[model samples]
Target: MNASRRDLLKLGTLAAAGSFLPAAALANAGSGVIEKAAKPLRILILGGTGFTGPFQVNYALARGHKVTLFNRGKRPSPEWPGEVEQLHGDRNTGDLKSLEGREWDVCIDNPTSLPFWVRDAGKVLAGKVGHYLFISTISVYADGSKPGMTEDAKLAEYKGKDAMAETMETLRADIENLYGALKALSEAEAHKQFGDQVTIVRPGYIVGPRDETDRFTYWPKRIAQGGEVLVPGDGLDPVQIIDGRDLGEWMIRLAEKGTRGTFNAVGPDYELTMDSMLHGCHAVTGGKVTFTHFPVADIPEDVGLPIWVPREGTPFSGYGAVSNAKAIAEGLTFRPLATTVTELLTWYRALPAERQAEVRAGIPLDKEAELLKAFHAKQGA
Candidate 1:
């Protein structure tokens, strides 16, 4: 199954009633920032309806910039600000035919994972936009197994012969195997056109409100229910995640500063363990639950654990620990994990009964119970 399939389901459901989310339930109200740019520029967002794209649009609008969205108009975001300009044309079919002669001070590409998409957009926006920011991921790195890796780290190379195929079917077929290589190739396509004008943002797991993945949000919702929660690896394993809201704001800032080159954008700026993250969730939501930490090996191979990367031998070896020095030095900051958990729970709870029926990541209740039984039996033996 596509790991991000559920992320697409929640794309249109911005369940929050308004801009203000419940903060009283949260223990920490992260360092809030309202940016007032030195000079606002017109910004174009290639994909504004998905996970982090709306946040980017909202932050750009808040920072006083004109925002235009380019997509096929399949998923319309009703929650977006009313002023967003929409241009409809499929990059795969039209090669950005709708964007000809259009110009923006900066263009943000949040949905382009295919090099063909980048090449198509580049053909149109080459001289029109002053800055081109491509949203890449830490997955682009050749080896995430090594901790403290930075932007200069080795990148994954596309194994496929054709780097320009832009079909969702192609993505679905090769995601598990070639996703990283393709993403790195896409980043290269952006650079091929814009050179120094490109700003590559390699973010780790992006979580927070408006995130449909339920990858990180799984903890907040699960803990709030309160029970014998099955946890992995003694709960001391460090995990790294960057909030979508924080990233959205930082993108606008980077564009305003006209930043160029690659940056590893992931962090809370320090070490954060699984237990500390769960504590924040429990404290914020008042979940009266007891966690049973099991050895990583105890976790059944079939049971999926969200956010807890296995340690023995995995491609995501350094997943819990990656460096963000370059991005931090350029003014990237993070909100407390508490604030993220609280708001996420608040939003998840507000969803309709049907919307909250299933989560995309993490073990299901039935699987957890079975795994816990075996785990305890082994301990007794």
Candidate 2:
């Protein structure tokens, strides 16, 4: 279903990007589209109030499935249906007593990065659940430099003989370095206990509304500001992203049919490039904007840019080129990139001033300005 949008300044962009957005997939949007609805089943979600989790819960409820959320009461979900049951426990500390002996038709593991979280929950949920769906990342892949990599590609490995078990603090300390490797470990734990009943989804660069991190949100925010935006590489570099809502909806369908195995959940529904992504943002923002391009070699390695990894001479050269054919064949559909841009701008503008100022990804405004100056100067020199 298409996410609802607000503050409609310009929608003409949707027409130009229509070719990129498939209308056949969304043929039932805005209308109650769950045909011959499957019998309602109970769905359990770990960390339901978080960014991606809410979308899963939202779509699950919309599809007539009941939801139960497991998390610390620290973040309550007022946006969700009031009738959904919620249980409290801390997964980091391995306190899963709240989930003991409880059963559901399916369980969606949304927040697990550490292996112990899965092992701890599996001990309790082993035969009690029908299917276990774990939300994972494309980061789990060992290499992205090779194009056309599929779901069966090499995965990042963690040594089994290592003496110490990974903890949240340890993962947090070197998150950028260890995240993928650890997610690989966690995926193993899910299957070790559940076997064929486990479904794993590996998404590339999850984006769109309610995204706390500025990773992909930076483009929409920067473009809407209407000025010289500093973008890395020539505008043709490859890029890939999946809206969080799209991924959530697909997972619901998977759970409904008891589909299992791995799928790469990245899309434009077609191949996409850096220029198309930026121009899509500009089209929706309706701004007198200019994108200043910098060569990949010019930007310092530590000055992290969001979403645009260089596709040459780096470990992530093929990052944006990961395949999604399997997922699409299995009914995984994507809304147009224009819909993502429009909905993201609407969501970002709704935030309070303080929260809006707290974007966690992308370069800061001053740093972006400094880089743009040096980029232009080098060209003039």
lDDT of each: 0.75, 0.74
Query: Candidate 1: deviation at residue 133, Å?
Result: 0.4
Give the alpha carbon lDDT tens digit for every residue of 171-195 in model 1: 6576755667778888888988887
Cα deviation of 75, candidate 1, in Å: 1.3
Worst 10-residue lDDT window, candidate 2: 1-10
User: Which portions of model 2 show Cα errors greater than 4 Å?
Assistant: 1-36, 160-164
* TM-score for each of the candidates: 0.90, 0.88
lDDT of 2 by residue, 116-145 (tens): 889888888999999999987777788767
